[model samples]
Target: MSVTMSPGRYRGLRNVSLPAADTFGIVAFDQRGSYRKMMGAQASYAQLCQVKSEIISALSQSASAVLTDPIYGMDAAMRMSPRAGLLLALEKSGYSGDSSYRKTELIPSWTAQTICQVGADAVKFMVYYHPESGVLAEELEALIKQVVARCHACDLPVFLEPMSYSLDAAVPKASAEFAAARPAIVIETARRLSRIGADVLKLEAPHDIAHNQDEAAWQASCEQVSAASAVPWVLLSAGVDFAQFERQLRVACAAGASGFLAGRAIWKEAATMSSAARANFMAEVAARRLDALLEIAARDARPWSDFYTLPQFDATWYEAYALC
Candidate 1:
């Protein structure tokens, strides 16, 4: 399917400023509560920032872009690696808390304009979505439209990540029932959000945790997601184990995924290791793992830019943009 967006937005998407714009093998470190949970109870903000920096330093050379959050590690990440392409996460965490159930909001300090000023290549928003949640779905669509308009005015590309979670009172979040329902829920949510005009879609692989190893089921899920997506879509690791994520990526790419924008599977261990060991671990362990994924993507992934016929650059066009 062809990408449907304005010419400016197309340029913005192409200008990812990565080693390869066609294929996005991005390393994401934009976790909050999840990172802390993966580490231990004592994981501090400072430690998170340090580990994020180490991951960027180690893997940025192999990765096309890096996704970082505004609060903890973005500044240090930007300062530490000027050449690496960066995408800033705009949303605040804790939306799932009982007090704030289904309320997704942007971080107070950073807006689309402000994020662009920080030299970000693009901006990303991760929304937890469930088709059954009527009011919440409407609220999220409104929020996405506002952000897309803001980003259009600023001429920045926006990536929308729609993740599924159960909202039914009777179905436990981790139960077999929730797992059984997630693949369809995820595909439908992607179709819904793709119509809202995001430049890119960062999706969770449709296979549930239990069915991840089922190749036939995964291929079916991938085909459904690829058919539903209007824009270029990439798969997120979703904290799955490295081998599982690697298999998921292969299946996704073969079934028409652009590539991957993975986080935890690439750098989860960095959070748990001591500061002294973090750098070495990132360089040796994390970098190698990322390289393996990149190899897989290069072998099987489709190029996002190839989906459209981009206009040839001429002297007049360069003059129009004041590039001369």
Candidate 2:
């Protein structure tokens, strides 16, 4: 619960407009060609730079927020420009002889350097709690303090993501799972995070979204998360696709998600990075959706040209009138 203060001057970031309250900002990681390396192809530094350039160029002058994690090392991504916001993974390394978990030396040093190298105001650090590490919440809390202290010494703001550990029964794979668990466990996760110093509470949402059946269940979980932390809550998309991505965004925004720590959907398409033709194609698609929504939100008096058709407005009528 103790918040650390920095020794250096606090550089307040300029006021950047938040994405529409109903709109969950999209941030694409995987600039390093996804977390796990491919079989044959190795993602080179040059390729990562190319991806970074494309991301910056695509951002244009729009005030959208972005979060990019490093590929192989923190240096590559840290050295590059952060057009949106920058984030680096500080995954916990399992404990040694003692029951305490250790922060990978690279994490504390690189994270500190990242904030010092890149201005702290524009940078944020993301740490994942690995349950297999035998590091309990108390130990994890201390690690967070140490990490934050490093950031604070250099005057940086930190955003934290707290997750539950689970394994797929059939596959025998360990992963961060929060979707299907008893309410108490989820609440405990939130409470633990709150006891530590978490600026933004990023948690997993309920997997299934039924029409009316699971509303109370979902709401109960959400309330627990909110009650456990004073910080605003955002959801990790859990790797949803484009259509599902959009739907999930709408649902999250409606469910009071402050923002999203999303990957895949924004970066999944090869076209989004590879070729100019592909890049433009993806950009135009995004622009169409974003433009339409922004136009509606901005409420521009002038009649804007409808680049993409609004077929889904009314399903039956939309289906009947194919091209309006």
Candidate 3:
């Protein structure tokens, strides 16, 4: 079944969340459990929020939009991201089931309408997805379709991120075999999830940098992903080192990607530093890195307008708009 969406509602909102160029150089500050681990197991809530304040304050300057959770980073992004747009995370920190077949757990008492009421510009949901998950994949797909319907009803654009993982216990995720299989898995996942009423597909780079260094093959895989996705796609960093992630970003952009929504690769180093040091690093290093990525995106990435037809309206368009 085809998921329903009101294109007239979200196209303008989606354009508002992106920069003037419409290429996405988004900041992913939505890490929850991973953020706690970065801040250390014993780190207090204040300490974690402070870290968010420092990082989001600095990089939001260069970013087109900031992706943050409602728990800790929302306050920081609300204050710091004056020029950039805000995308709030709707799901919980981690998955529910075991690593073999993970399941997304959305936060209780949160709905798309409530997210809009909270003053967010857009909604983001990240789910663990795989083509071979059988029943689990169908369940996740259904959940995504439901979320999309809710969001579109409220006229909010949804950024859907589907993270891929290894299904076989014998071949661990870090193994070369898994890396070799990553391109096909990622491409097929994009094909599957892009049809589920998402306004934008936040995707993994099809080429695995750790196991492969072939730039040509990397670009080819990225181009395939671009072709497979029905909507415009942006690459996720997936916590690779900055240097390698930079390389991946370039290739993806060259292969017709819209831009990126990255997290750890840019600011993971500053999470462990003192407030002053973190501030300095974010301002000097992370901000500059974002500037560079934005430069790359401006040069090569396709604008999101390529996917959605931006609506033209008369001055009385809002008279017909539904506030419910």
Q: Highest lDDT among the candidates is held by which one? A: 3
Task: Write candidate 3's Cα lDDT for 1-324 as tens digits.
Answer: 222335544453454345566788888989988788777778999888888977888887778878888889866966785777778899998998788889998899988888888777788999999999999999999999999889877888888999889998788878899998989999999899998888888988887788889999999999999889888888899999888989999999999899999998899999999888988898888988888888888888988777666555788877777754
Best by TM-score: 3
**By lDDT, is 1 or 2 better?**
1
**What TM-score would candidate 2 get against the native?**
0.64
The positional error of residue 180 in candidate 2, measured at the CA in angstroms, is: 2.8
The all-Cα superposition gives candidate 1 an RMSD in Å to the true structure of: 3.1
Candidate 1 residue lDDT tens string, 153-188: 776789998877778767765678888887888889
- Residue 18, model 2: lDDT of 36
lDDT of 2 by residue, 115-165 (tens): 456543433444434444454545767877776666545554455665444
Model 3 local distance difference test score: 0.84
> What is the descending TM-score order?
3, 1, 2
Estimated TM-score per prediction? 0.89, 0.64, 0.94
Clash-forming residue pairs, model 1: none
Clash number for each model: 0, 0, 0
Model 1 spans with C-alpha error above 4 angstroms: 1-8, 15-21, 37-44, 96-101, 308-324
- What residue pairs clash in candidate 3, if any at all? none
